[model samples]
Target chain A: MEIKETFGLMARHTDDVIVVCALGMSANEWWQVTGSEDTFYMHGAMGFASSFALGLAVAMPDKQVWIIDGDGSLCMNLGTLLTASGQGPANLKHFVLNNGVYQTVGGVPMTGASRSSYTAIAAGAGVERCYTADSMNALSAVLADIKKPGHCFIDLQVERDDGPILAPPQPFEGPEMKYRFGRAMERRFGIEVFGPEGY
Target chain B: MSNPTVHDQLVAALKRCDVGLAASLPDDWITPTLQRLDREPGIAHIRVAREAEAVAAASGAFFAGARSVAVMGATGLFTCLGELATLNLRHQIPLFMLVSERGSRDDHRIYQEVQGRRIKPVLESLDFPYFRITSTADIEELPHAYEWCRMQKRPVIGFLARKLLKG
Candidate 1:
């Protein structure tokens, strides 16, 4: 299925859930699908969205945290797989958008696209539960199990749409994006993301 | 009773700052502190494979309204400069870090000499504020430093000095 469709299906499950998106395709698609300021649309630090989401999950154990990571982004910091698995945060969900190419830079096929089994890699990295959803039906079939209480990794195989695929990203970035997301979290959760004078 | 060691002092300072979480990639100087943090009931510690993972994770905790810190060596700090600039600098996110201040005149490791010479200059160039904590008194000032980082809305490094760690 298309990246947007995968996001569309996952968007339905986002109530009370925190979404962290890797920069580029994952960020743009999730922003286009959700239009929510609350989810952190990371503008940089290419592969560390999973790390960021894991941190968010550990901090707020009461909330569910999911990261929309792409294949390109995942390769940049595969060591994160080890880090996340070691933390073993039950509230966190790892979702890789596997489109077999660097979809943002122009859909050039990545080196290990055919040979790399991300699910197998995740499992080998000590992730307790791993799933693969290659189609809408497959994703629908596994949503319940994947969403259950435990550390889970889901590799979502998405269509490699021709790049320069111009879906707009979340408009605001830098300090504006920070405050937008921080204030939204404070208001939504009644938590203190900033100090009294507002940092 | 014996005086609290530097590790103990630093952990106490973190507690005083209300820091409840830490993500760390250990350097030898900071390993004992990381081990102590691992057992500290009040602080949730995660051992990351790489330095940038710790930075990103600590950044994540900032949004959850919990104070957090990252611990690594000077070399590890060198590895994550891009993440520091792009994520923390770009977003104006506050991250508190404790790192081993390596490559001092007393430090014999030839490999660490480059890190000692370059780390502070690099931090200076980025305008990412950093403070040196060389004694127990300096450790006491950690809460103040942590608050300053939060107020500045950027990443700050508390470099644990070789004198203190080796003492």
Candidate 2:
């Protein structure tokens, strides 16, 4: 029911794939769950993490890429759905943590929170397959479906947290985040993310 | 040897850079080049919904070990400064942008005047390195420009002037 429970369900599936986390709660919660230096945690540019994942997916066709987005972040850049579906890279998956509130900057309710159907919006945006996971059982089923390769969207409904804080963000950020993630990519994939001089 | 037109030369230049991917959102002056990028065999082209997407997408390509570029109009470039500053500048990620250098006196478009007048000063304030490419010879800077971006670990804009784009 909690967002952490949703993340707990997701943590199992993230081991082999690259995850791009949208800044704020999504970034914080994902780190708390996984403690992964390999995932790219967006510190800013709130709405474009989906776009970042799309580019990574296109570049690394042999690998799977996941975007762990948030409701507010998705609304800010709804057009990403069109770009994702138009490109339709089978290696990518979109997951939105639909908690209906901005949990990080304090629990402010997101606009159109209760009324908007994100799955329908994704479908209209041309995503061929969409799913909604409102419970643990539903989330488990959807996660199983995504294990197979395809471009799919999942709207994850979880309980709202009206707390001063939920989970802390990863300690390393900005330049450190870049180097750590880039180095992890090089080590994991046997590729050169930086030049010989290490620039 | 330079190609006869703007798009031709830009495409050839990208090929020389071994750029494997490109993201673009078009403005009229940059439309042909965007189309040419769409058609390039070696480059995987993405047509994004917004200019910030192009900027973010190119930043994403870095982790894949792929050389990438973004294209947009001057006004479009203006739209993504926050993303550029926060995402790219904060992380010190390299991004190379091919942008329409609008707002020149010869352009004569009143709508573009604001973008032309403000874009450079804004870039200066952000301390982002940019080069104005006004002729075929200036195209040489693009390949080098991108390398400098990677070396500097920041956003670099190659502003394609009206003389280069329209001629």
Report DockQ per prediction, comma-separated.
Answer: 0.90, 0.88
Report fnat, model 1: 0.89
CA-lDDT, candidates in order:
0.90, 0.90
The Cα error of candidate 1 at residue A93, in Å, is 0.7
Off by over 4 Å in 1: none
Clashing pairs in 1: none
Model 1, range A1-199, lDDT digits (tens) per residue? 8878888998888888888899988999899988988889899999998999989999998888989898988999999889988988888889999988888888888898898899999999998899999989988876777677778889998888766658888888889988988898899899999998988
lDDT of 2 by residue, A79-157 (tens): 9999988898898899998888888878898888878899999999998789999889999999899888889999998
Best by DockQ: 1
Candidate 2 runs further than 4 Å off: B1-3
Docking level of model 2: high
Q: Compute the lDDT of residue A130 as modeled in candidate 1.
A: 92
